[model samples]
Target: MPASTPVAHSKTAALARVLDAIPKGYCRYTQGNVSASKAESLARKFHLRYGIGCTPAQRVTRRKRGMANALLVMYWPEGCQQVEWLMLATDGQGMDGEKLLDIADKPGMAWLGYELVRRPDRGRTAWTWRRPASEMAEHYALIAEFGNKHHTNSLGSLLQRLANQPGFHGVREQSKRLFEEARRRGHAGDLPHLFYVQKVSHGEWLRLG
Candidate 1:
């Protein structure tokens, strides 16, 4: 399916589709807007990958119960790529956006390419978080190490440290520009969240909350 296409006919269906699409064993279903039977019915009618009925609330709870080495998906209609959306989703789900951002910011996951995508079918207008799993195998060791280092798992804190590292100034500048643009576009919040940052051989790239 096209990345932008809505996977289901309704918001509940859309959420269920996402829950099913997540790699098996990583999540379990809980009731939300859609009942268990309804979720299963929609999944079957839509031929979704997983026929689990779950809500964003349930998904958040399940995520917290497991390890912190997973991607977070946020849905918003305003089309903001700023940290505000991350924070809002985290607050709604009862998970920590900073921690999830830390996992996504790892050097090994850089290839996953953090970006916001618009999903029109789900709600006429909505954006979903995306990190393609194209190179997960190559970064398994680094990701595992990251999982082991729970003490250093805050994206904001990590970014502060990276700011002191050589050659990270440009990255910080770019992030500032993005934040400013988001603010100008009315997407700014009281505090910002760090989303993803990558340091390649040539330069660094960053996405802020």
Candidate 2:
């Protein structure tokens, strides 16, 4: 399908199936050829969406990698140069890598994007992933704030701690405190613009705008 065409629900489902069949390993799996064409289409859509030139050679390479990456790198074609999107597989072993397939067709999951997901095994490791850290120090500083708070309760507790800090009368105060905290922790940017402040029974609660 052309890049301009609206993606259909059925097509998305098919893409999900294709993604599901992809084996997560260093060695190539022959079984995936059944969906090679569809997988190639999905890959083209992905690279094209990002303005990556899709030459026949690059196309073949991407097709192989799409069907294969612990760390797949794509260098832009000449005159179409751009920063590469790093496709890092979380696991060197295939066990955790298989979890990536689960991201397919889920709500809030991008078809061609990496995501964070808990493994189904007893350990429940975070098999999915996040975007690469920003090169900008300021942007990375904000990301540092909640980088380790993956659990809902842990995150809520952190927020509650911030809310309970003294001298906070409202959401603005809370947000300002957050900015100050980020800055204190090495955020080099200006006060971040927060768009919302929610009020609770006890006091004003900070909600990211």
Candidate 3:
């Protein structure tokens, strides 16, 4: 399939086809909108290698659970920008959150601005999408725009509210632009991936059925 193709079909199917088109034994992951079923389905579709454990449901980071929908990973050697898109199918907020912060501590994953709602029994941070400021309006504009205010540090919030996706909010696109520029200047800071939820019918995404 062409890079510019809209991929209007199921993301899992489309990603499977794309993976098959690549070299054998390639690794991949999915997050947010890209459910576990999608990841497993696509992995099996291409017969590529996948992880060996299930410590965290869907292989998503434990810190980002509930905060994210899902994550996909496709690792390739450096100097392959086109592969960036394929790898994007499984995004990670810098495997090293502290390191990512050392690099870009803008918002979203870092300084989340929201509220806390719950009794002593149990409670968690909460954040909603915002319009976003110029400091945070670039590649994300293609998906959604923050409302100028956001708050949440929960895993679900990170994935559903923070990670990049169509109609999503709270991403600093300018930071993304900078991320891209860094990559262009031989400074690819971190791997960028797509995110999605499980309700979209990913279908047994975590297993190689």
Candidate 4:
């Protein structure tokens, strides 16, 4: 969970460029290898909090999904950085401990490491994982119902106007009402709750889950 660690050598220009290309608040880069045990321990720090109507197994499954996606960016001596390992589990990424150790054993290979990190921003605009298929279907059904109810104002026209307006105050108010309606209809689940009303296209403002 450490965002950074001190290393004696300065970052090479290539490494700096790689770091710049990576989006902020996603991962942190360091100049050394981390033990598997250490990486797992770091991954353990992320826990899924239980919520109303959520089961313990669901929480565990989601946590495992997140940990499996935690990638380690490795820079080999060949001057290339690639996702060489998963922080917690290796099965999905086609990597294992022995393979990593063998690569480290090679001589004259420079290595840089990067691991996923938690973001401090709590903004609603942040990207999120998609919801379950059943839940998404409910949202789409609701959208269709709303379109039928408000035939005078086409959904595409409303979305286009929202796109033109800064912050889209009018559409945002509509989104808030729809979210409340979804919750009332038991469409929104308790865990992994939907927060943002994202704009997927000029003609659509939807929670893309």
Which candidate should be chosen as best, given TM-score against the real structure?
Answer: 3
lDDT of 1 by residue, 49-165 (tens): 221223445445655765222222222223322211111111124333224332223242121133323345445643333333442232333334443554234333433443332
| Candidate 4 colliding pairs | none
Writing each residue's lDDT as its tens digit, candidate 4 over 1-209 gives: 22321111222322333333234322322234445434323323322111111234643564566522222332222322322222222223322222332111323123332211223346633211222335445545655665556542444443344233222233234445545554444443332222333332211111111
What is candidate 4's local distance difference test score? 0.31
- Compute the lDDT of residue 143 as modeled in candidate 4: 52
**Candidate 4, which segments miss by more than 4 Å at Cα?**
1-88, 91-131, 151-154, 157-209
lDDT of 2 by residue, 84-175 (tens): 22232322233232334323334323322223233443654323222222322333344355533333343344444444332212333434
RMSD of each: 19.7, 17.6, 17.7, 20.8
- What are the Cα lDDT values of the candidates? 0.31, 0.33, 0.30, 0.31
Error of 4 at 166 (Å): 20
Better of 1 and 3 by TM-score: 3
Query: What TM-score quantifies how close candidate 1 is to the native fold?
Result: 0.17
TM-score of each: 0.17, 0.19, 0.22, 0.19
